[model samples]
Target: MIKTENVSMRFGGLTAVSDLNIQISKNEIVGLIGPNGAGKTTAFNTITGVYKPTEGKVIFKGEDVTGAKPHKITERGIARTFQNIRLWKDMDVLENVLVACHLRMNVGVFAATLHLPGYRAKEKKSREFAMSLLDSVGLADLAHEPATSLPYGKQRRLEIVRALATEPSLLLLDEPAAGMNPQESLELMEFIGKIRDQYDLTILLIEHHMQVVMGVCSRMYVLDYGVTIAHGTPDEIRRNPKVIEAYLGVD
Candidate 1:
């Protein structure tokens, strides 16, 4: 559903990503894996419009969206979670998700300011939809709890749920298993697959945990120092000399 052609990002004298190319088919889960400083997040930033690529094109569903604003890209059916959890500290779980649901609400500013009937109606619908999303993800009971009160794993899940509130077709997840134990990572792998099937989503995942990525992604691309070193199925990647050398230093 998304393709990047020769995409590169340069910061003054530094090139963070170079000639990166990747294509994800509909409803497919793909992995972007590399050691720290391999430019994996840089590639995601370019694709999500956080940073405009210095060269090449980012095509989503066949349309070029290389330099579009982040919100514009979100409006075009893409949503993303960051490497760090970014839930609003003061908001409850449901409220955090509600903030994202507002992206799709059609009420005018004047109507919202006045709390008109139409605005109220839309707000009701957004709440119902958001609640359903929480229910689906098993977070409904904790809806009114402060977002920061959730455990780290649930916080990660909440961030994904908030992104889902935007109703995206393509979801970019950055290190969803960052701080989890092995068992928690295993559960996260299951959760990722469950959400993909439940939401009919195409996912691009960046994960440092090899088990999670290998367990969930059918295909992956490995990068090193701003260059794509290999792209293939997990088995192929595991056996690839270039990938091995990138992740495990060679003497």
Candidate 2:
């Protein structure tokens, strides 16, 4: 569903990602794993248009989408969640999700001002769909609560839910397990799989948590110092000397 060919991102004298190539097939979950400075998030930023790569192409569904604006990418069936939790603290959980759905809502200012039948209908449907998404993620009862009131794990889940509100065919999750406990991470692994199955999504994620990466990803790619070190199944990655050396600092 997504491919990056010879992609490189540079910042003045520094190269964050160099000649990176990754391929993700439909409905498969792929992992990008590496040490802290491995440029995983940089790769995501380039793919999502946050930073245009200095060289190479990002192709989505066979079309070159490199350098397209982030919203344009989202509109074209890609949605992403950041490594840090980003939410509307003042808004209710439902409201937060509703904001993303605005990209799909076709109501005009004139129709909204007149409360036209089509506008009202669409608004009602959007609400229903938003509630359904919250419910799917087990957040329905908190629909009226402020988004920031949720605990950390729920906040992470909510961020993912908000991304889903964009109705993406391909989902890019950046370090979804950043600050979770072991049990929470385990639940997150299950949650990721469940969402993939329920949403029929093709997933690509950058995760520092080896457990989550190995547990959820059908295939994995390892990077070191902004370069691809190894790519294979979890088992192969675990046994790879290069990956071990990168992570463990072994000779």
**Reference-based TM-score, model 2:** 0.98
Across residues 1-251, which tens digit of lDDT does each residue of candidate 1 receive?
A: 99999999999999999999999999999999999999999999999999999999999999999999999999999999989899999999999999999899977889999999999999999999999999988999999999999999999999999999999999999998998999999998899999999999999999877767998999999888999999999999889999878787889
The RMSD of every model to the true structure, in order and in angstroms, is 0.8, 0.9
Please provide, for model 2 over 89-112, each residue's C-alpha lDDT reduced to its tens digit, 9 standing for 90 to 100: 999999999999988997799997
Model-by-model lDDT, in order? 0.95, 0.94
Q: List the residue pairs that clash in candidate 2.
A: none
Full-model lDDT, candidate 1: 0.95
Taking all chains together, the TM-score of candidate 1 against the true structure is 0.98
